[model samples]
Structure formats: structure tokens, C-alpha cells
Target chain A: MPLDPSFVGRTYPPTAPYQVGREKIREFASAIGATDPAHHDPAAAQALGHPDVVAPPTFPVIVTMAASSQIIEDPALGVDYSRLVHGDQRFSYTRPVVAGDELVCTNTIEDVSTRGGHGFLTTRTDVSTVGGEPVVAVWARYVIRGEA
Target chain B: MELPAKTFQVTRADLIRYAGASGDFNPIHWSDRVATKVGLPGVIAHGMFTMALVGRAVTEWAGSPDAVVEYGVRFTRPVVVPDDDQGTEIEVTARVREVTEDGLTRLEVTATCLGDKVLSQARATIRSAR
Candidate 1:
């Protein structure tokens, strides 16, 4: 079954605000091997001139997944969760995420396509501060294996 | 603070252990048959695993888990791990890019596996713990 074209331009409600905590950022950094003192030490970060330890650039994926759930779980989209695989991911940031900033994510189904009997779903999620200040845009591609 | 570099060898067991921990069971990571059937030359490593390793490097560098604030990366190439003595490894390099007045600093990063960039154009912002 093909994806409904009407869903292509559909947008989901912005996710609830996520408070950027210093600990969470540190944990994520450690998990990925980001050791810059600025990521862990306030004095180090301050010496370098940041408000607080900044987050790694890719941290936005944490919220984009929440925002994208709206489109992925929509039955009309005809996606099979079991068959889905992460195809690609990319992020463009206007600025790095910082502690003390409340962030929100909004997801849009950018495109739907099929190839080799498989379904491809592309999503564009924008992360912004509660005041709507743009922080980053994450583009993700998911591939659903053929249902044959 | 001065940035440091680290490297790690990713083995089949490591990938399997990560699979159990991360919940990403993509067969291309652990099954040779499935990987080759899917058009890959051989079994490959998960991009997120590579990303996670980069984070490990950061954490180890910080000397504590609470120092990092943010991290991000783009998967540029696939890392294929084979079953042999010629094991595979990834080298992660980082540099302090800039610091904001609010006390956050941005670090530029890169991860290379098997002489090719598996993660590229990576960056992270971290706050000082004081």
C-alpha cells in the first residue's frame, strides 16, 4: 500500500519543552566520547566563554524522535515498525544547544517514496527554544522493507 | 583545556554487546549472511555505535560523566568489521571550536574507521561543572 499523499505536508504539534540539564548533556557526551572540558566543567566552559556546558551538536536527535513519533505511528502512513531501518541522519545547527535552554521539536513529513518494493519516509524536524528561537534542523530517512 | 584523541577496536562481540544495550538489532551489524544479502560486502558496524564510541572518548577525556552537555554527528561512511586477525578500529579526534559567554564551549570532532571517515563534521557544546 502506498502512503497517503495528504500526509506529506502534515505537521505535528511541537513537543513539550525539554530542559537541557548539565548532567544529561554530560552523559550523552560521555556515551559518544565527547571529552571537551566545556562539556563537563562550568569553569572550563566559562573560561572558553559559554553560559554553561554546551551540548554536543547531535543532541537534538533526543527530541526529534519524540516529535517524529506522531508521523511514524500514524496508521494512515502505512509504515511497518518491524521493517523500518534507519537509513540516514543529518543535522544543521544555527547554534549548539546549551544548558538552561528549554527546547521544543516540531516534525513534518517531508517526503514519501518507494523503491525496490520498499517504502522510504523522510522527516524534517526543527528544534527551537520555547520562545521559538531556531536551534537546529534534523533530517532523517527511514526505510521500511517490502511486505511481501 | 587541551583536547585529546583516542582509538578503540570494535569487535564482533563488542557489536553484539552494544546491540543488547542499545536495542538496535540491525542484522547488517552482526550477521554476515544477512549483510551480504543486503548488498554489503560484509557485516558492518552500527553508525550509532560509532557515535557512542565518540561519546565514550569524550567522557573518558572529561574524567567524569557530568562534564559534557551536548553532542552530534553525521554518518558519512559504513564501517565493515570482518572475522579475522585484521581487526577494525576507529580513531576519534577533537578540538575546541569556540566558547560562549554563558559558559558553554563548542568542540569540533571527527571519527574515522578503517582509514575512511565513518562520522564527520561532528560537534558538541559542553558546560563547565565549576
Candidate 2:
């Protein structure tokens, strides 16, 4: 069975607030092999005029992905978790995500389709601060192999 | 959640290696002239490449790429790598935020470039092994 069309436009609840910290930033930087000081050192980040360490350009994916599970795990969506592969991803930012800000995310299903024995799902997630400060919007397409 | 802060560095060679690894040859990432033509100060790194670094961070921390059920990021700023003697550096940090009822783990994370906000806000979900 394919995904439910009714699921399109469905919006999930907002994720809990997450506080940005220095250590988490450094660990992420090192894991990605990003040897940049600004990700870990507040003094370096301060020199660059930020409240604390600033995240790299693609950091929102972390939060948004967590929020997206609402849809992926929905039995109504009929998505096969084991067969899914990332199709494409893009982000539009209202402002940079600096450390020390409390953040949350809301995920919404944008579109659903099928082609050549595969299910295609598109999702849009909004990551923001608790006070509703827009940080970034993530648009992603995922592919699920058909059960042929 | 909190952890000890750490640091890292990005050398010129790292950019070249990333270019090769990701199969993205955007001249803006390798050629100063082309980068400047596009309005960048100098060679700029690919946004996805930077994010992949973050992915590696989260995946390694989770102990498996397959564990990363979902992840995303926005390119808030350009990581400008100058033609100076010392190369630019991109840093990152991550921590476990929560564990869901079904054993899903959410990570709060951030990555930066030499103090500039390169990757503004980031997060990921790691599905624990069943």
C-alpha cells in the first residue's frame, strides 16, 4: 500500500525546546571532521561577535529530523522505514542558529507520490526558538522502495 | 544536557579532500577567482559538505550511520577560506537531548566556522538498535 493522501498537509506537534551548548557543538564538529574552532570555543566565537558558538550552516537538519519522525512513524503514512533513502534536502534560513538559544521544531507533510515501484515523500520542518524566532525551514524528499 | 567543550581545525587539504569525497567540484570551493566571481570573498566550502561533517559527528557518536533515522540543516552563512598561510576551521558540538518512549534519541547540536555562525541550528534523531 502507498501513503495516504489525507496525510498530506498534516502538521505534527512542536518538539520540546533544546538548548544549544558548547560541548555538543565541538563533538559534532569533530565527528564531521570539521576542525573549526568557532564551533567549540566561545572565546573564538565571541571574537566573531556571536553570543556563543555558532552552528554550521546545516545544523538544523539535526533538530528537524527528530521532529520528522512523527510522520515517518505514522502507520497511516505506510512508509517502510528500512527501505527509505534520502532523495534531496534544502534549507531556507531566517537567521543563523547561535548557541544559548532554546529551540523547537514542527514537522509537516508537504506531498506524497509514487513512481517506478517507489514511494516518494516530501516533508517541511520549521525549527525555531521557544519565543517563535524563525531559525530555518527544511524541505526534504525521501524515497521508500516499493514492496514489489 | 551538557558536556565538555572541545575544538578542531580545517586545513586547505581538508577542503580538497571533501571536494573529492562528496563529488562536488563547485569552483567556489576550489578556485579563488571563481569564488570571487560568484561574490564570495574566496573559496567557500559546500554547505552540504559542511553538513556531512556534522552527520559524521552525530553518526559516529550514535555508533552507526543506520542509527541516524533523520537529520537536517540550514546554510546560514558562508565559510570563507582565505588564501592565508593558516587554513580555516569548522567546529561542532552535540549532546543527547531526550529519549523517547520507543527508545528514539534526539540530539541537540551546533557547528561553526571560526566564530562565524555557519550552521545556525541543528538536530538529529538516532533510533536505537532494536
Candidate 3:
């Protein structure tokens, strides 16, 4: 079944604030082999004018992906999780994420379409500090394969 | 100008670690059976993982972890990872597309595994370190 184009422009509520942990940033940086001191050492991050250890560029996916579950699991939308594949990703940052920050994500379904028997869903997530300062805007496009 | 290429190795162990840290427990990234069942080649690395590697290259080139202002990529191909001690390798290279007077640098990035381009329209805009 093709995605409901009517679902486009639907916006979900903001998720609960997620406390960005120092060790989580370190672990993510380590997993990607990003040895930059700013990603690991608070002192190094402070030298760079950051309040705490900084997160790697793609680290916000950890938050946004979870936040997007609201849209993916919407029974009315009827998305097939097993057939989904990542199609595209983009991030625009107002500032880098730092450990000790409490972040919240507001998810919006930007577009939904069907082409060549496949369903495409594009979502935009606005990540912000608990105080509502925008941190980054994340966009992801997921492709749902058709049963051929 | 062309930037030096950076190569990163991806082993199955690394994938497992990433899955834990990123909280994406998708079995297709670990279970070859699930990957094949989904019509994938077999146990593909998470697309976000590959993007993170490329982000590393961008930040390294910019000389700061917070240098990037915008980054985007289209996932054109899957980086299939075989279960082994030596999984696979991704090579990332970038070219300076533009340098603004205010010191923003735009880069066109390329990432490949087994000489096949895995990402297309990959680009990053960062604060110029120079």
C-alpha cells in the first residue's frame, strides 16, 4: 500500500528530554574511532569554548531515531518496519551537542509519497535544548520496499 | 583542492558496538539471516555508521569537532559487511567546493567500499580552519 499523502505535514509532540551523557558521547565517538580530544575530554572541549564534551556530528541520530518511532509506529499510517530502508539523511546544526545537555526532539512528517511501487517517507526532527534553544535540524528519508 | 583520503575498517565487532551506542538494535545490521531475508546482500553496516565515519573525516579536515554547520548524504548503496575479523573498509575523500569570504568551506565528499560509491550527493559545510 502506498503511503497516505495526507499524512504529510503531520507533526508529533516533543519527546521527553534526553539527558546527553558524557560517557555516551565518548562511547559513540569511540565506536566511530573519532579520537578527537573534544569528543572525549571535557577540558579539551572547554578549550574549544564548549561547556562539556562535544558529540560527534552524527550523534543526534541516537535521539532523533527514537523520537521518530512516533511516526513509524503510528498504526493508522501502517508502515511496515521490516521493509524499511534508509534512503537519505541530513543535519543542519545551530550548534554542536554537548554532554550534560538535556535535549528534546519534535518530529514532523515532511513528505510521503509512493513511486515505482515503493513508499517513501521523509521526516524532519527539530532537536533543541530543554530550554527550547534549537540545537540541530535532522532530516531522514526512509524507503519501504514493495512486495514485488 | 583535493583533501587527503582517510580509510576506516569496519569489523562485525565494531558494528555491534555501534548498535549498542546508537541504540539501533536492528537485526539486519547483525543477523545475516535477517539481512538476507530482507533481500539485502548480508549484514550491512548501518547507513548512519557510514555517515558517522564520513563526518569524522570532515571534522578532522576542519580541525575542529564543531566545525560542521550542515551535512547531508544520499544512501545510494549498502556497505555489505561479511562476518569476519576483517569485515570491510570505507575510504572517504573530499574536495573543496567553495570557500566563502566569511570563512565557511563547502566540501564535496565521496565514500566508497570495495571501490563502489556508497554515498552520493554527500556534502558538508564547515567553518574553515584556514
Candidate 4:
């Protein structure tokens, strides 16, 4: 079954605010072996003009990935989780994500298409503060592989 | 213009830590049992992990921790990570494709594993640090 093209341009509601934690940023930075002092040292981050440890550029995936389930798990959308593979990912940030920021995401389905028996779904998540300050806009394209 | 290349280690431990940190508990990244069951060669590193490595290189080249304004990539191949201390190594290299007068530097990036390209069309635009 192909993805519902009508779902394109459909926007989901804002997710609950996710409070960015300093330790989480440190852990993610450590996982990627990012030895930048600003990622682990609050004092160093302060020197850089952030309130606390600033997360690495790709850190927002921690928030967008979870919030994306709102669409992938929607029964009407019929996204087969087993066949899902990340086709592409893009992030445009207004500013770096720092610790102590409460973030919210509003997901929108931008495009849906099927080619060569593979289903492609592109979704954009507008990540912003609970107060609606734009932070980063994340775009993800997922490919649903066809049966061999 | 050419930028410096960087190599990153991708061990199973790194995959596990990335899974926990990124909340992508996909068995293909951690469980060899499930990974092979699904026809993968073995447990593999997450695509996002590779992207993160590229981000690290971008920031290093830009001379700022938060210099990236736009980043994107396509996962073309998987980085197979073994269950060992020295699991695998990904070599990331990039060239300055353009430097707009507005102070944004666009980079064309390539990430390879065992000499095979793992990411395609990987690119980043950073606010160049003067």
C-alpha cells in the first residue's frame, strides 16, 4: 500500500515542551566523541554566551525523532515501520540548542510520493520554544523499501 | 579549497551510547542477533551517528562549536561496526564549495568507511568564523 498523498501539508499539533538538560547534552556529546569544552563545561559554555552547556548541532534529533512518531504511527498514514530507512535529514537552526530551553515541535507532512515501488515521505518539524520562538526547522525524508 | 580530514572511531559501545542518547534503540545498531536476523551483515552504526561525526568535523573546520546553520545528508551505505574496542573508522573529508559574501561557507562533505562512500550529498553551511 502506498502512503496517503492527501496527508501532505497536514500539520500536527505541538508536542509537550521538552526541557533540554545539560547532562543529556553532555551524554550526547560524549557519545559522538565531541571533545569540545562547551559541550561538557558549563563555564566554557558561559564564556561562549550560552546559559549552559550547548548541545552539538545534531542534538535536536533527540527531540524530533520522538515527535515524528505522531505521523509514522498514525494508522491512517500506514507507514510500515519495519521497512523504514532514513533517506535524508536536514536541520536549519536559528540558534544552537542550549541547556535549560523548553522546546516544542509542530510536525507537518510536506510531501509524499512513491517511486519504483518505494514509498517516500517527507516531513518537516518546526521546533520552537513553548513561547513560540522559532529554534530549528527539521526536515526528514523516510523511505519505505519495497518487498524484494 | 580543501579542508582537513578527520577520522572517527565507531565501536559497538559508541553505537550503544548513541542509541541511548538519541533514543533510537533499533536492534540493527546494538543487537547482532536481530541485525543478522534482518539480513544485515552485523550490528551497524546509526546513520545519525555518522552525521554527527560529520557535524563535528564541520564545527572543527568552522572554528566554532555552534557554527552550523544548515546541514543535510543522505545515507547511502551502512558503517558496519564490530563488537570490539576498535570497531571501525569513518574518514570524513570536505572541500569548501563556496563562500558567499554574506559570510556563509558551504561545504561539500564525504564520509567513507573502508574506502566505500557511506553518505551521499552530505553538505553543511556554517557561519564562517572570522
Candidate 5:
């Protein structure tokens, strides 16, 4: 099924605040084998001017992926989850995410198109502090394989 | 200038751990049955996972965890991992694209697995280390 082109430019409500945890950052760092001391030690991060343990650059995906469910599950949009594959990802950060920050995500459908028997959907997620300080803008493109 | 290349090994166990940590429990990354049903080569690593490893390499190059200002990648090919203890290896290499006067360094990165490029147009901009 083709995605609803009308969904382009549609923006969703801001998600509830997600509290970033030091442990969660540590776990993500460990999982990726990121042994940088700043990713694990508060003192190390503080020396580098961060409030707490610093998250890796790709860490925001954890929040954006969950927040994106608002669009992927929309009955009106008709996204077949089983056929979806990640096509592209990008992040532009105003500042690195810290362990103690409370973040919120606002999802927007940036583009929807069909090409070569495949459906392509692009989404932009604006992540910011609970107080509305922009932290990063994340973009993802998903390709839905056409039926054989 | 060319940054030192970094190689990371991807095992099935790492995928499970990443799934638990990242909240991405897609069966195509773990269950071979679902992966084959979906026409995948085998249980594949999450694209985010591969990106994370590249992020690690970028931070290492910059000598700081918070150095990255912009990062992006196109998932060009799947990094297939067999159900083996050795698994597969991903090698990441980067070249210095430019250094702006404002103390930012731009890098053009490439990631490959088994001689096949897995990511394309991979790039990053980081705060230059003092």
C-alpha cells in the first residue's frame, strides 16, 4: 500500500518528557563498545563541560524511534511495518545529550513518495529539553518494499 | 589527513544486547526464521547499531565524546552476521574533508563488511580537539 502523501507536513503532538538516565547512557555505550571515559564517568564528562555522563551521537535514535510510532501506527497512513527497512539516517545536534536531561520529541512527516515499486517515507524528529531548548534534529527515511 | 581505521566485530550476542539497550527488538536482527521469511541473508545487525559503532569511531577521532555536531549515513547494504562465535567485522575509515576556521572538522567516512560497502555518503562534522 502506498503511503498517504497528504501526511506530508503533518506534525504530531510533543511526547511526554523522557528522563535521560546515567545508567541508560552507560548501557548504550557498553553495548556499542564505546569505552570513552566521558560516556561512563560523570567526572570525566564534567571535565569536558557536560552536566553528567555524555551520550553517544546516535543515542537520540532510542527516543526518536519510540516517538515515531505515532505515525507508523496511524490507521490513516497505512504503513505496513513488516515491509519497512531503514534507508537513511541523519542527526544535527545543537548540543550533546546529557544523562540528566529531560527530553521531548515532536515528529513530523517530511516527505512521502513512491518509486520503483517501493514506498519511501521520510520523517524528521525534533528533540529538545522539557523547557524547549532544542538539542537535535533527527531525520530518517524508511523504504517499504513492494509486494512481489 | 586520514584518520586511523577502526574495526568492530558484530556477534549475535551483541545484537541481543543492543536490542535490549536500544528498544529495537526487530526479529530480523535476531530470529533467522523471520529474517529468511523477509528475504534477508540472515540475522542482520541493526542499522542503528552499525551507526553507533561509527559514532564511536568518530568520537575517538575527535578525542571527545561530545565532539560531533552533525552525522549522517545512507544504509547501502546489509551487514549479515552468521550464527557463529566469530561473527563478522565492520571496518570504518575516514578522511579529513575540511577544517573550517570556526574550529570544526569535517570527515568523509566509509564503512565496509566483508569487502562490501555497508554505508554510503557517511559523513560527520566535529568540534576540533584543542
Candidate 6:
């Protein structure tokens, strides 16, 4: 079965706010070996004009990936999670994520198509403060490979 | 302009830690048993983990932690990690593709593992140092 093309351009509601914790940012930064002070020390981040410890550029994936499940897990979409492979990823940031920020994600199925026995799905996530201030836009392309 | 190369070590432990922190507890990133069952050489490193390392490289090149304005990558290959103390290594290199009038530098980045290209069309735009 193929994913419904109608899902394209369908946008989901904003998810519940996810509190950005300093320790979680620190842990993520540490896992990637990003030892920059701005990722750990709030004072250092403040010096850089951020409200608190700043997350690495890719940190929003933590929020957006979870939000995307609303679409991928949609029964009507016909997505087969077992065959999924990440095709690509991109991010555009309005500002670096800072600890203590309350963020929410609104996910949209930007495209859905099938070619050569594979299903291609693209999702865009709008990450913002719970107050509706835009933070970043994250896009992900995933492929569901069909059996030979 | 050419950017200095940066190398990152990817250990199985790092994969486990990244999985826990990122909430992407995908078994292919851990649990060799499942990975092999799924036809992978073994447990592999997460693609996002690799991208994050490249982001760190880009920021380091731009001389600031918050310099990246945009970044993107296509996962061309899976980085296979053998279960060993030494794990594996990824080497990142980039060239300045352009410097815009608005003071952003565009980078064309290449990431490789085991002498094979692991990412294609990998690029980043960053605020150039003053």
C-alpha cells in the first residue's frame, strides 16, 4: 500500500510544550562531543545574548521527531514504520534554542509519493515558543524501501 | 577557502548514550542482535549523531558556537561500527563555497567513514567572523 498523497499539505496541531532543560542540553552536547561553553554554562550563553544555555543547532530534532509521529503513526497515512530509512534532514534556525524555553512543534506532511516500489515522505516541523514565537523549521525526508 | 579538517570518534558507547539522550532508542543503533537480524553489519551509529558532529565542526570553523544559520545533509551511506574498544572514526572536511554580501559563509562539507563517503550534499551556512 502507498501513502495517501492527500496527506500532503496537511498540518497537525501544535503539540504540548516541551520544557528545555539545561542538563538535557548539556547531555546532548556532551554526547556529540560539543564542548562549547555556551552549551553548558548559562553565563556563557548569556554573554552570547541567549537567555540560558544554548542548545546545539541540531537539538530541535529531539522535539520535532517526536512531533512527527502524529503523522507517521496515522493509520490513514499507510506508513510502514518497519521499512523506514532516513533520506535527508535540514534545519533553518531563527535563533538557537536556549534552556528554560517552553517549545512546541507543529508538524505538516509536506509531501507524499511513491516511486520504484518505495514510498517517500517529507515532513516539516515548525518549532516555536509556546507563545508562538518562531524558533526554527526542521525538515525530514524518509523512505520506506520495498522488498525485492 | 578551505576549512581545517575535524575528526570525531564514534564508539558503541557513544551510540548508546546518544540513543538515550535523543530518545531515538532504535535498536539498529544498539543491540547488535537486532541489527544483524535486520541485515546490518552490526549496530550502527545514528545518522543524527553524525550530523551533530558535523555541526560542531562547522561551528568550530566559523569560530562560534551559535554561528550556523542553516544546515542540511543527505545520508548517502550507513556508518558501520564494529563492536570493539576502538569503535570507528569519521573525518569531516569542507570548503567555503561562497561568502554572501550579508556576511554568511556557505560551506560544502564532506563526511567519510572507512574511506567511504557517508554523506552527500552536506552543507552549512554560517555567520562569518568579523
Query: On residues B1-130, what C-alpha lDDT tens digit does candidate 6 reach at each position?
Result: 7888899989899999999889999999988999999888889899999999999999899888888999999999999888899999999999999999999999999999999999999999999764
Worst 10 residues of 6 chain B by lDDT: B121-130
What is the clash count of model 4? 0
| Deviation in Å, model 5, residue B66 alpha carbon | 0.3
- Could you estimate the TM-score for every candidate? 0.66, 0.55, 0.98, 0.98, 0.98, 0.98
RMSD of each: 6.7, 16.1, 1.0, 0.9, 0.8, 0.8
Note the clash tally of each candidate: 50, 35, 0, 0, 0, 0
State the weakest 10-residue window (summed lDDT) of model 2 chain B. B2-11
- Winner on DockQ (1 vs 6): 6
**Each model: TM-score of chain B?**
0.90, 0.85, 0.98, 0.97, 0.99, 0.97
Task: For each candidate, report its DockQ versus the true two-chain complex.
Answer: 0.17, 0.07, 0.95, 0.90, 0.95, 0.88
> All candidates' lDDT scores?
0.75, 0.71, 0.96, 0.94, 0.95, 0.93
Docking quality class, candidate 3: high
| Interface RMSD, per-candidate values to 1 decimal | 5.8, 10.3, 0.4, 0.6, 0.4, 0.5
Query: Candidate 2 on B1-130: residue-level lDDT in tens?
Result: 6533334455556677666544445677789987788567889766766677666676556653335555766567877876666777777787788989998888777877877767655777777753
Candidate 3 chain B lowest-lDDT run of ten: B121-130
* TM-score of predicted structure 3, chain A: 0.99
Determine which window of 10 residues in candidate 1 chain B has minimal summed lDDT.
B59-68
Model 4 chain A: ten consecutive residues of lowest lDDT: A45-54
Question: Taking the tens digit of each residue's C-alpha lDDT, what string does model 3 give over A1-148?
Answer: 7789999999988999999999999999999999999999999999999999999999999999999999999999999998888999999999999999899999999999999999999999999999999999999999999999
Q: For residue B128, what is the lDDT in candidate 1?
A: 58
Question: Residue A27's C-alpha lDDT in candidate 4?
Answer: 94
Error of 1 at B103 (Å): 23
Residues A16-110 of candidate 6 have per-residue lDDT tens digits of 99999999999999989999999999999888888899999899999999988998898889788999999999999998899998999999999
